[model samples]
Target: MRLPLPALLCCTAASLLLLLLRWRRRRGLWKKVRAARQRQERSLVQMEMAVQRFREQHPSVNVTSILNLPLPELTEKLRDGSLPLEHVFYAYVGKALQMATETNCITEYLQESETQVQKAKPAGKLGLLYGVPVSLKDSIDCQGHDTTLGFIKNINKPVAEDSVVVQVLRRQGAIPFVKTNIPQSLISYDCNNLIFGQTFNPLLYTRSPGGSTGGEGALIGGGGSILGFGTDLGGSLRFPAAFCGICALKPTGNRLSKKGVVSGIRGQKAVAAAVGPLAKDVESLALSMRALLCEDMFSLDSSVPPLPFNEEVYSSTKPLRIGYYETDFFTMPSPAMRRAIRETKQLLEDAGHTLVPFELMNMDYTLFNFCVKGVFADGCASFLGNFKGELEESSLGLFWLMKSPNWLKNVLSWITKPFMPRLSAMLLSVRANTVDEVWSLHHEIEEFSQQFVAQWKKLNLDVMLCPMLGPALGIGYPAKLSVAVSYTMLYNALDFPAGVVPVTMVTDEDEEELKGYQGYYRDYWDRTMAKAFHGSVGLPVAVQCVALPWQEELCLRFMKEVETLVLKNNRLI
Candidate 1:
């Protein structure tokens, strides 16, 4: 039966009212975001004018020579009082300004760096990084600066205290001079966001630098920063390092004080983010690790294990029993990355390290079940809470899918099963709904990790080598190629330490193979993967080094070994 005319009219009026309210709320969010962006633009202009004046006054300074110095030599000169601290700092500031201008990587200039360097000194035990200037990913807290992870609502709300990492850096006499851009919500690998715009790959203008640490990658890869801090959850640190031909370390979780390091999914410990450094070279990464694991960091945050940098483990000349895999079963690695692994394996063997074939196990259960499902146990309701009044980046589609109701996912999974079974299986894998379900998910994760440990012990492996995603994917493709991170995220699941070093570029043959790229499954995701690698020739590709938990120093050693071997081989050739 039809309702009375007045009651029907009332129902229609209420429906229209709700939509109007939604439209008004969305407009308000954009307005806040626009104001925040205007403030950033104004600050940038002021900083640029100040940089111009400094350049004119220091016209005779050899900024080029200073920028070219290696990290060790640069730090040594500053330590012995041979190089003026102010000169080196300004030189990087100049280059950093140029980098930010080119790629839109910088969020705000920490102009107070000038004041910090003036008072810098080789003052006792914690002065290992004396007079060094560094950059930070935007999610870290620095006193008096906003830690906007590219979200509009996060702007202008500066933190009251420094993050544990920042405090350690300052005490070690390293000046943190700039905060760089990240994807909105810090989820996607692409660097584009609504705030501060997109940060492009420094080498290939059209390619992505990779995220959520893409800004750090771009800056250091372009020679603007010698060392910079970044965090890796899935592949934040390593992806950018590989994509932009830099070096980075993603240490085991709970190894550092993450007190003020922000994450959208806060308090999720099943798979926590690991804080580490991105730099121009492996030695610079090692230097950063050594400085970060000091007494200052220990005292500031007690949760960090009181472990000092193990110099002996790093300096040991004993041969390693290394395990390696060219690719994983979850996603087919690009041809160039597989070649990178093989090349690295031969080089390591030449240097007296034993290499054995290693295959990844149980990714079908691990990828969507434990990681995607368990990582966001709340279905991302809690994370989505942060985006209510914010203009988020476009790449958060996955986050929303993860948050969808089980009934909806199941229906979609069933509908697509015949045509796209892998994706259907992925859709069905989002199982952690209740508290019991989450506990069960953890049990599965622990068991999977143990199985991997069993395999490692059986092989007697001290280190491992593997592929990192692809030869620098084109911009806007990482979201669909999410499965490619299986190579890296396996370590994250097991809480093992890992690092990436640039080793090879995509050769003519590599690109030719990429053209014939047939993915594991001929589904939507795979088709997108093919398109992502279509124009990726000449881009840098790198191999990943993995070690067990709490073996960060040893992991660094493995990375250094690869870097040295590759460079020596290149020189000989």
Candidate 2:
């Protein structure tokens, strides 16, 4: 029954030819990816040069003094005509261009911003954020600019109108000058994409600024922009703020409009994405929230509740009950992170605020089953679908996970369960094949949220203080150590208002102490953490402050308390 040798040889040749054709096709696609990236990079370079020319033409503008004033003070100055709109705008543009050139943090909009500045000068103090230069995360829509979200497939696809958030900010006299970069899928914590390349931390080029709000982290952290906006689904806002040594508030969903923001999974709402501020300090964050939550935002998007920032709650003089935790049940925080929580707890206790011990029961299952699972529902098809032709380096790990067949994943989970329970549990939680399954998961999320709220009520805590995962992770660490975000994701799962304030810096002593530390599971993630944090000395360490839903003002107030205490004690670097 065997075929003749000549016939078999002919069949083998045909197979080889098919393989060659496929390889050539892939090579062609890769060439297109490269060309697209080159175009984006060239635009960035030209924008940088233009900014330089503008700066040289206006040498009298003192960006240093303008940047010195926080967002609130700067707004006051603008309203009183003490700070010229052009001067402030160009100062930031100049600084932002310099930072973007160095860190690759900015995507585009320098030219548009220059035009907006000219327009703002005539309008004069129209509203709260008058004359303020606001930076936007790339996912936000700006008319005439591409809301790429770092995908090559999305490159050059210009949005026709401003997002609701952008419209609201513009009405308040805020000029959206430049857009910052983000990770490819806007899902990973490390900020890099094929289109925008990688955004390096201004502090250390080897480390990541954190994401999906990483560009804001680098730009604002480097003092390029005073106030910026970033959307947080998991730890997007707070993680970058912590990594970059800035402050940010991940407000409850619906607090700000998410109408025109581009997301991989547009309608997935189990752990809803929220638009929030990433800024230099707590005051700037509070001011941004006030401006973003105005009547304009509510009218533009009726889904956004008509709730202005509550100044009274933020300025309360009453004593507070603060609950603090050193570890989420799933992982042990690094020494620097642990110290941040412990030190913040000590400072709060000294300030006459009562500190209560708090713990979330079943954090591991809750995070994986509820938060992480919800995000990856549909097996990450929507996320992967965005990759039209090529894949991003940041998404490789996720791609592997998403592309694997369920039967294979189940088999591997069973094989690993005996030795690696955590990995197995993670694998077991990646459900979402049907509407009924997603519905059941959504119901579970609601139940978990209700239970957690009940626990918070019983504790009677004004706010909770906990460790932000670790100091800024090294570049590419997000791929392997994705679960490290569980600390912040827990808040997202509960839909609580959370903020991160810089408390201290990673020190040699902290690094040395962390070497001997063993986490709750002493697994792959802990090993990866030790490696990632080894050379992270002098990187910022921060703590997470959480409050009940719709209590963003209170969250900012507590964050301000931490920032003040840290500054007073000379804890911040």
Candidate 3:
């Protein structure tokens, strides 16, 4: 049965050739990575020169005083001609550039913003956001800037036209000053990519400033930008806001248009993505939302409903019934996160608001069946398609899970079924689904959404308060804790309007208690949680406020209430 000498020699030569080819491909990918870094470096240098030139041209502008003014007051000043529009723009741009240098949060949009500043002269009547400097997430398209979404392949592909949201912001006199960084493929909670490097938390550099809205979080949290916009599918906006101690609103999917936001799964609608604002205060978020959800947005994209921000509902002073929960059943929140929810509930109750204990029905099944299964029914082929042969480090975990051969996955599931039942179940569930399976998954999602709404109605609640996915996770935690996104993903699955307001910070006491914490499942995720909060002291913790779909104004009102209480008590300034 032994092969002839010549045949064996031929096989060995073929194997060597294949190895050489693989090495060549890897070398090319690394070259692309280096080229991208160099390009970004050049852009940053050019931006610095532009900023210096601006500083020399406007010597007596008092940039510090301009940044001190809040968004509302700043708008009024700009309207009355007390503050020059160019001065206001440069003030924010200067602060933004400083923060971006420290955290690596900005992409290449400075030169374009300089042009925008020149074009922002006030007319007779000031627009809602006149002279305001607004930041945008990387995926949001600006006509001349590249919407990379942190992909090496998408580095130089400048979007030819602005997204509908950007156009609307401009129409309202908001200057789109900068584009922020994001996680690769805009999916993981950790924000790192080869294109722009990793964006660090301004408060704590060791931990993540959650993604894919992470760049916005760091800049706004660092007091660099007054308001910024980010898109969310699974906690992208809320998680970062919580981690960075800022305010953000994830409105119902249709409320804000998503016309030109670059997404990996752009066509996937099983769980729709939403564009929302992140800002320093709840009022700023409200202002941005009002400007974003306008007739202009609807006119550009007919899919957007012509629903304006309801002022009356947002200003309601009636006593409210609020449902509250500490955990979402998939993962137990950290001590600081749980404390944030408990304290917010206590504050609302003391403020004449009624609080009721609430639990999500079949949360575990809903997350796995609808959110997870529905989004990845095609085994993440669509999500992976945008990488263009370069795989980001953060995406390797989910990528491997989705790309593994069926036989290997089955074997792993079988082996782990005895001891690691939870993981075994997940392994079995992650795979390429059929057309019929996808359809059935969508049907189940509809049923689940209806059931959730019915449950809410039965409770007769005005709003619900819950914890975000633990306190801002430490660096490199998202790859291991992928399933821990259940809390925020639940809202997305139900299409609810959710907002996050910082209530407390992670203290030594919170970290000490987490050391002995035992999660509900006591599984791999729980173990990961235990280790993730070790160096997380002093990180901000926030709670989520949610309302039924299209009730964003109500959601913002509740967030404002919580924010006011937190500020008055000096719990968070």
Candidate 4:
């Protein structure tokens, strides 16, 4: 087994060379690690300094401290010279800029914040949300500002005219400073676009602020802005507000004009979309709604209803009868959302409101067969229009269907469905309408709406309470896993006025209990729901308060009652 002397010498030289190379590699790696550590330290120091400067520059004023203060009080302060419009505007603008930079919440800035303040100052009076800094979802247009809608190609192309809603807000003395982030194609529930990147939840940097209204949710939730305007066709407004612990109302169709907002499916109006306000409190939402409704929007858009906000409708002495449900029968809500519903029910009942158990049997099939996939039958062509050039990593989910060989998409919809039974049934049941199918789906949707209305009439309930989503999912998971719009979509299908209101926070118990979930939809949705729940510790759990069409006042009244009861019981305010 002994080697020759030459062989031994060669082996010795090779071992020495190897040791030298190893040493050099180790030294280089160490240097990189040290440099990374230094960079991270510097970043931390910069963040702390920025936060400190923010605190010093904008010391908490009595007015700013009252986050839940009614809009009327805030407006009164601005009008009486107790609160300077400039100071309020600057303070919020500063906060939003700081938060947006730190959290990447804002998609595009008008950068004319100072000019906006100057313009509002000479008025020397309050209109409604006087000097209240507002943020809009990127899909909304602000004249001369890019409504990229989160596509990189549209970055420099500014909108020629203001969106009708933006015009209304501007007239009401609200200073719109920035356009917030949105999802690619404005399709998914995850808010990352090629142009502006992802928006993080204000409560947890690691979790998502739901999309496509996610940016507005993140900014407003982080206390960067007092008011936000977002549009919802599916669960865009409700999901973001629920995820970020803000309040929002998706009003009935034609109540608020959607004249100038951009959309993925521009003319695919099978499910109507409404533009609405998102705020820290319900009163702020109402204030914005009232201001927008005041302008007689019916004149501008013949589709808009002339129904003005009625103050008297919400002022009821008698207790309201409310219906509440924990699970949607499509899938059970996560423990936290379930707990929120139970607690909210208890609080309302304690407040002398009658709480009824409401059930829409097989609600998933109703929502699916009618509203969602059927509406997009001619396909998501309009939605898929802006995917030219390089696609962002985030936009990958939307193309999952297209990525499959057309045969696989077709085959999977048929064959692989039985294994993942519930979702398979859902996916298979989704008949992307041909020209003929589109009319049929629309007819089906109408029929479903009629059935739902009949059931609501039978219930005789003022409002129905349900989870905002099934659970508080982690950041990037909704779109990544693709199973978010359950609770909110049902409302869209029915075209009901549904509002999201936060009630409680997720608990350790909630997380622990989800470990044993055994449900029928036991495929992507089940696994995704579990993964989504994993990182969402202590996030707010919210519920949707839904009412009949044109019953927005009743919906608000019910929401106010629920909010009052919850806040008083929890001592949140």
Candidate 5:
């Protein structure tokens, strides 16, 4: 095998060149990356062109004041002839497109928005929403737009009908303006996919706007859309709301119709995604909830309950017995999150609302046994299968557990036990394989729900103050700390009506505290979490409000109270 030095060098150089060529070839193909890029470019171009055409056809008007005006005031002005539907529609359309440019937040702007605005009745003739423009999360079906949910395979196929929520919005005279971006299948909190690239936080380009409704979060946060409707299976709505410094409500599942929504695998009802609103303010969210839980929605979707908004519960001046928890114990509360909670808890107490200490025990167990298993009963084959013959976004790296064998997970769980007990425990938590195991998982979730309800009743809690995920983790960190969803995912599992209200911003001290964070387990998860909040200063911190099943109005009332208290005052306490 011996060869001259010059001959060996020539052979090695030839091999190196061959390897480089092969690498470049793979990158060139990129598993449909080129097609996805072209699609995104076309979508954005169409949006810009539509906005430009609308501007050309309609006379220009100052929408600054209209944009600043809250939902209630805007609607009132429209009804009183002080504001025109044309101006409001254009204001949102232009701003949404602009925000999309800055943040990559929107998926596709609706072409029929102009038509919707033109046909709209004048001055309160239509409905409660009267000419208000609304943005929808990408998963909510729009008749002519493709709800890709970040999959290339799902592209170019427009829906045949409007999602029930969209129909409800139209019936209320609300124009669905645009469909926002989302992470493909919500494998991570940060929104990114091959189809639409990534959605950066409008507040800070480097930070992530939580998802899968994150596009709505960034768009609304950037003042593009004042009110938007989104869904939450596992904090999809709340995460974005918190990250983007906005308000949102995740109503109990089945409260709003999900008939036409394009979400998880068909017929997989492990954990139902509830549709609700993300708004500039809590009152707007209340209004949205009121509008959605109306007869229009009830009549349109037979699957939903025939329950209208209970004005009495929402408007009641009575004090509430509130339960609160500063930490979920699974993920250590960030300094900003802790402060938001304590301050809100203080404000609630000062407002004569009782704040009882409520602890969320066994979150890791709950997260795995209930949420993860329930959502991925089939070991996530249905989810992973979607990515077949497709380019996968990097955010899905952590979501590859199902691809691994049971023996491997068991071996990893056993191997990592000593050093990373939390990780080991998670690995040890197996997914449902057979139908019998699936039924058992369902029974377990029911039992857990019953137990949670029992505890809520035992505490006599009218509402609860919760620590929300916030201060916008750096990009890619949310996925790394996926289990850190302890705060919001708990509600999703319990099917409670949870809402996020921005209370305060991260301060210098909060940053210091964040730097000093040590996870409860003191494992990699803890250290990674500390590292995750590296650049969290000045970002908005929010507190979550949770209410019992079907008590959305009361939840809104509680959210409004927290928002009011936070805005009112809380001097050196």
Candidate 6:
């Protein structure tokens, strides 16, 4: 088949051109496949490692010994010098290390924490939270620890200075032993990442701990550590506390220092995030808040108002009126949660306090506007920027737009109509609004805030009691519908002082009742909620106590009263 030299050269050239194009196409496809497979492999390895670590970390540790000793008892031991700072530090550090191994709750453990114990002063000079081991979410800066916030690329970067809270905690002699887990971008409710992996509920390994403060919740909730720090803009603290049955507060924005805290959305001032604590009990949460509020944080950052912890607010002895609601404006709470709210109201009323029913103004509009737009207004680019690898499935629920195909996503409004009616309607409602629209929403938020204050004044209430949301949700359920957290996020928008206190535990009866549920709306939200509420039996149920802004002391006092009433009435305390 020998041919002329010119024809042979032409055929060889054509063959080479085709080979080059094919090689480029194959390379691109392989890269995509490799990325997808790597993501899955990493997730599986993380999950397996978490399980293995849990088994190895606490082989002989007495979980009961740690649980039996409450914070007050620990404090007494520390005060009398019976328990050295090292003893307290070791006990919690040991437990936290164990919990972190099992649950993957830690992003960074301070290997040099013993140095903190060795340098601790005697009891006379120690402040309120002295010798206590407090963990911070990875997002908050602590000197000498990398505030990775769960990004692998951030692992090598160490923080140069401590955040304001870290400095305050150190001044009080609290050992910052570990940096707890958080979501990849701190945007989703679920806590999972490629770097530190997923943070599971210590109570139930399969379930979420809640985030962006989920690690704080898991560590404290599991009794691995007590009196930990967490931040909340939209229920980041409250949601995890509620899910794990721990107590927490989301103080009014700017009331707590936001400086030196690392976040994906650094300059998002529209809905400000406030740093606070997650603790084992109500007293712990109060004490932690008081400690942070000592001398006021405004000095460190002038943006914060120079208001000290208003002492007068806590002096009221009156059995004040309280408003109770089972659900927020957006979603009706699960039956067990509603039951918890009703039970709490009955307990309070029986204790000689007035109980009234109240509804948040345009709860639906407020929730849709503030949460969807205000939080993700930057189009999640900021959040996605932190990820050098593939997105975790737990986070996809938050940034839903990322996975959608362009043509289908573009014409979603049209496709939504009559196709998947229930979901269709929700998509139309939840579609992100324009920046100008978000600005208007922000103004409306201010108006809503004023109206909320007016409503509180009209009620003349000391504290309003409500459910934190449904009972302890099923494991992995938070990934399904985190939007339900609006119940807690609503207060954050109002910048009110709200505390979550565990009131009851979900029971068989609650599950049986939930099965017979019937709501007027047959929307997708309703059906999805119904399914999610099914397996959430036998978990803790908690109530949220809310008061006016800067009234944290008053809110805690009222919370104790309600706690006392519930305990005395049920004889559970």
Overall lDDT per candidate, in order of appearance: 0.84, 0.84, 0.84, 0.74, 0.83, 0.72
* lDDT at residue 194 of model 3 (Cα atoms): 78
What are the TM-scores, per candidate, against the unseen true structure?
A: 0.95, 0.93, 0.94, 0.86, 0.91, 0.84
Task: State the lDDT of candidate 6 residue by residue for 1-573, as single tens digits.
Answer: 898999999999999999998788656545644553354345335534543454475466444564557777776678678765655565676577678767878766665566777777674566777888888888999887677665555655778999988888888777887778888668767787765667888877766787789999999988888888888877788878878888888888777787878875676656667888888777777777767776635667787777766556665677888887777646777777888888888887777889988876656566656655566555544555566443333354535754344344447747866655434433444444577876887797788889887887798876788778755455555666756767777877778888888878778888888887654355655667787667666677788888888778888888777667767777754
lDDT of 4 at 512: 90
In candidate 3, stretches whose alpha carbon ends up further than 4 angstroms from where it belongs are 1-29, 391-398, 571-573
What global local distance difference test value does model 5 have?
0.83
Give per-residue CA lDDT, model 3, range 375-456, as digits (tens): 7777777876776577554453656767777678789989998987767767766777888988888888888888878888
Q: Which clashing pairs does model 3 show?
A: none
Show how many residue pairs clash in every candidate, following the order shown: 0, 0, 0, 2, 0, 2
List the candidate 5 regions with Cα displacement exceeding 4 Å: 1-60, 430-432, 570-573
**Higher-ranked by TM-score: 2 or 5:** 2
Q: Candidate 3 clash total?
A: 0
Q: lDDT by residue for model 5 over 505-532, one digit each (tens)?
A: 9898988777678979998778888887
Write down the RMSD of all candidates, one decimal each.
Answer: 2.2, 2.6, 2.4, 9.3, 4.7, 6.1
- Model 4's TM-score against the true structure: 0.86
Q: For candidate 1, which ten residues in a row score worst on lDDT?
A: 391-400
Which runs of model 1 end up more than 4 angstroms from their true locations?
1-24, 121-126, 392-394, 397-400
Model 4 lDDT tens row, 1-573: 999999999999999999998788656645544553353344334434544554576576543554444566877777777777766665666577667766777755565655777666645445776777788898898897767666655655778898888887887777787778888777777788654567888888878888889899889988888889988888889888988998999999678878789876678757877788898888878888777887546666777878888888876757887887788766657878778888888888877888888777876676656655654555445555566543343363446564334345567777766576554544544434467777877787888788877877787877788777734467667765554576777777778899999988877898898887654467666776777787566788888898999888888788888787888877754
